[model samples]
Target chain A: MADTIDARIWRGGADGRFETFSVPRRASQTVLDVVTYIQRKLDPTLSYRFACRVGMCGSCAMTVNGKPRWTCRTHVARLEDGPLTVEPLRNLPRIKDLAADMAPFFDKWAKAGGRFVPSTDAEADFAIVEPASAERRAADAGIECIGCAVCYSACDLVSWNPDYLGPAALNRAWTLVNDVRDAGNADRLDAVAGDAGCHACHSQQSCREHCPKSLNPTASIAGLKRATLRAAWKGGP
Target chain B: MKLRARAETLLWGAQRASAAVLAVCVLAHLATILYAVRGGLTAAEILSRTRGSFALAFFYGLFVLAVAVHAPVGLRAILRETFGWRGVPLDLGTAAFAGFLVWFGWRAVAGLFA
Candidate 1:
């Protein structure tokens, strides 16, 4: 019996080759399983990053057959065709073979003021905000991002404009936009506006489509655009 | 930094502002046409009233201005994204195209009114 599983892994930095791996076939195997088998059993030196074996952690995202996906969630049997090409997530700096540097991706979040800068600190009591309220509801809807960089990897605008605050960051901004207690509204808008910010988003919705959480980062981006436009017009914080 | 982003930002602002102007112009033009056609006016008669009036000139001028500002910016972005053309060459080419739109659009409106 010939042990045969044709998998093409991106091998090297920016300038890399799609080195094929003959991963052994297995039942109920996943894309991560294939990558793991290649890294562990076949080639001990294959550089790839994965935290949790499950889909909760978004660390295992890779361009599987030209689409950004959480490899842990992607079953190998479903995509066990002839050629399986894996590349680092798109629209970001590639650090190694399959691992992309996520610093810039998270940096934009900080720049967009993704943090909930409360009016009061830990010494102060919890300010009561009804979950049923419109603002809280909006915030709650978009609060589940795992920072997997899937949306960041899937965006074309981020690819075109390197300085663009990718969808996840802007989406994070939108959540804070609705946070009534968050005091950095004006500052956030200032950070998110201009050529390299939320205004740069073309509303292509690749982020929404590729998001593992089924969250609409595009809608959140639209929300930010509308909020920023209104805030700008009104000169509001 | 790349000029494409700055150009795009300016274009987005232009698109929004021109869209506002276009909205009012479209409504006014439509209403004016409806009013004019109610009496079954001839083209020559329509020209006689519309011609040489500063208001008509202004309205048409604003209309042309909106088109001039709007079309080429959108076209440039669409072209760049679709064709993968970037950098200073594409930027200059797009800026020139926008200028051409403004010039030709004003000329057409000028002929219609002037």
Candidate 2:
């Protein structure tokens, strides 16, 4: 193992260039640690975002060696020996050196009806849903999404079609679609249909491939496709 | 918005349905070609077997219809995603392409049947 690792980090906004820094190699050091060292020790002006320094926050996701990953969880030892290149997540507006504008990502999430709507008021009796029901199980398959936008950055369709809701949002919608207690299926289905929605997905499976949580947004999008088709067959929702 | 969504979904359904049909039609067509060619049959010999054959006409007609339906819908998506083309113009263009495919394909099928 080399005593130092050469890292090329993106600097500035959309017009930024990668600036190289020699970061000290440490055992079990993650990619996030390299960025942190660059910010704290090398160049104080370098900007990035992270919280918890763990995989849970999902804020530390970036394009590492041309792949979107949670930097906090990506160990340098696991990567092949080469100069590390990190950049802001693709398909989103660049905010700074390593942070991307999350507004569009969240906007699409809202457009996909990621938020849950209640079937009954709080005063009403609690709705009982079977945990082992087919719908529940299907929803559980993709419910572990951390909203990291990693899947969004990894998606090719998102880059092609700006209006695409991408994987994470559609995955969230799928979970809501199967929520027996939720009453937003009609609007949610409408939101996730059409050219910019689940129909746009080419089933490339990039979302499923790059998701750090091992969630399958591609499966969720497939569910949305079926749901939308059924809804369309029955006429407008 | 709802109408557009419904239309897009219906197109998606058409694309998938046509693709499934094409899958079976293509495999059968390929297998038939391989079987027919094994005997070193000439073009005229192949035409003699196909001409006035109701089974060939029906199968080939279905194949043409599936291709007409499937290709245009996929092309529409490609035009939109790759070239940023959309709206009624794109829709009309792809629809016309489908019509052309149907016309051209059916003409060939008709020739085989005749």
Candidate 3:
């Protein structure tokens, strides 16, 4: 194995270009480790975002070799074919070197009704939801998303339409839609039903393909389509 | 805005429903053509089979309507995403395109039927 690996990392915003640095390679070293090494040893000025190095927080997601991935989990061995090129996630404004602004991403989430509206007040008893039920199963299928925005970055439609809700938000809405305890069904359907909502998705399955959790937002979007169609036709939502 | 949101969902549903119809219509049309052309029929022979046939007229008419519904909605999406066109003018243009499809398609069907 080569003693050192060439690391080409994005160093600025919008018009920013890639800058290459050489880092010592170690066994079982991850992409995040390489970046951290460069930031600590080679260039303290190099900027990036990461909290949990174990991939739980999902704060360390970046574009690895032109695809969105969790750099904390992406091993150096898997990307050894060429100089590992890392950049901030796509379809978002760059804040700085390797850091994309997440305001638009979270804004779309809010627009999609990603937040759950509680049906019961504090005095009310806990709602019993069966894990085996169809609705609960559907919700559970998409509930593991850690807000990584990998699916959002993978979505081509988001790049085309700025107003698009993207995959993560739609997936969040799907879980809420299927939740029996959620009181936001009608309004949530309305939120995700329109031109920039679930209807805008191209059903290309790019979100499903690139999700680190393997959650299928395309299926969730399809469910929203069906739900929204019923709501529109029957004059419910 | 609320009306447009409701209309968007309905439009999406209409496009999908029309697509299902189109799938069947396209397959049946293709099958008919392959069957008719297998032994090589002359122009007169083809016209004789199609002219004054209620079944062919009905099938082709429905096919034309489905295409009229399906194509322009797809075009609306394309235009909105590609050219950033929206609202009244874009909807009007897409409806006009649908009308053109209906006129052009029905005229051809009428030629064979009449």
Candidate 4:
């Protein structure tokens, strides 16, 4: 077996090109380790992002061999036979080598009204939500999303429609929509009801297929679609 | 002017509803065509069965209208996403396509009745 892996990484902004580095392969090596070796041992200026080096932060997501995945968890053994191609997430502006500008991604979340609007005062008692209730379960299903843009990068709709709210934003909205304690339902529905919102998702399930947390943003978006329809029909937001 | 959120939601709902109608209509239309041609029926025979039958005419009329409603809405989403074309012109263009679909579809259906 070959002891070295070829890592071809994107090395600049929008006009950047891929730069290849050969790193010594070891047992149980991850894509992130390969990148770290190249940055620390080979070149000092190779830029990327990662935190919590486990699967929790979701900041280590990158396009590995043309598929969006968390580099911290993506072992090199899973890749097909070729040089490992690592690039920044797609459908976003690249800032540097392997670093995508996340402003658009986060902006969509705000635009979709992903923030929870507080309806209670500080002196108020904690709202009790039954854990087994349908709404709570639905909210729980998508609540673990770490804001990783893997789903966004994988979404074909986002690629085609640059203004799309993307999966993360819609999923955030969906979780909130189902939250009984959340006071932002009406405004969130209004925000996600339009062309750039939940209506724009084509149900491609690319987001569902690529999410590191196994969250189905596609289903969340469908929930948003239904919720928005009722809200829009009632003319309430 | 800001888009009417309710109207946009209704548009999405209409597209889905029309799509549901199209699914049934398309299957029934195809099955009818297959059944009509199965015994090697002549063109005159086919026309004879459809020409004066109010039931067949109504079914086809509904089918045509469903297609007219369904296709243009789907095309509207496609045009906006793929071509980056939106606003009044895109809406008007899809509406025109719907009109054209209805006209052409009814003309073909009407030929059988004629």
Candidate 1 C-alpha lDDT tens digits along B1-114: 123333344557678789899999999999998988986998788778866788877888888888777776676667665666666787678778878877887787677676
The number of residue pairs in model 1 that clash at the backbone is: 0
Candidate 1 per-residue C-alpha lDDT over A1-237 given as tens digits, one digit per residue, 9 for 90 to 100: 235678899988899888998888788878899999898887888888999888887799999999999999888778746677899988777888899988999999998888888878889888889989998998887899989999998998877777778888988999998988888887887777755677767778889898989999988877777676666655565
Determine which window of 10 residues in candidate 2 chain A has minimal summed lDDT. A228-237
Ranking by lDDT: 2, 3, 4, 1
For residues A1-237, write the lDDT of model 3, one tens digit per residue. 779999999998989999999999899999999999999999999989999999789899999999999999999998749899999999989999999998999998899888889988989988999989999999999999988889989999989998889999999999999999988888889889867999988899999999988899999999999989888988886
Report the number of the highest-TM-score candidate. 3
Clashes of 2: 0
* Error in Å for residue A65 of model 4: 1.2
Quality of model 1 by C-alpha lDDT: 0.81
lDDT of 1 at A227: 74
Clashing pairs in 2: none
Over 4 Å off, model 1: A1-4, B1-14, B20-49, B52-59, B68-111
lDDT of 2 by residue, A189-211 (tens): 88998889999998999999999
On DockQ, the leading prediction is 2
Could you tell which candidate, 3 or 4, scores higher by TM-score? 3
DockQ of each: 0.19, 0.64, 0.62, 0.54
lDDT of 3 by residue, B23-52 (tens): 999999999889989988898998888899
- Residue A192 error, candidate 2, Å: 1.1
What does candidate 4's lDDT look like per residue over A52-100, in tens digits?
A: 9889987989999999999999999978988999999999999999999
Query: Candidate 2 lDDT, tens digit per residue, B3-112?
Result: 87889999999999999999999999999989989969888998999999999999999999999999999999999999999899999999999999999999999999
Question: What is the C-alpha interface RMSD of model 1?
Answer: 6.4
Docking class of 1: incorrect
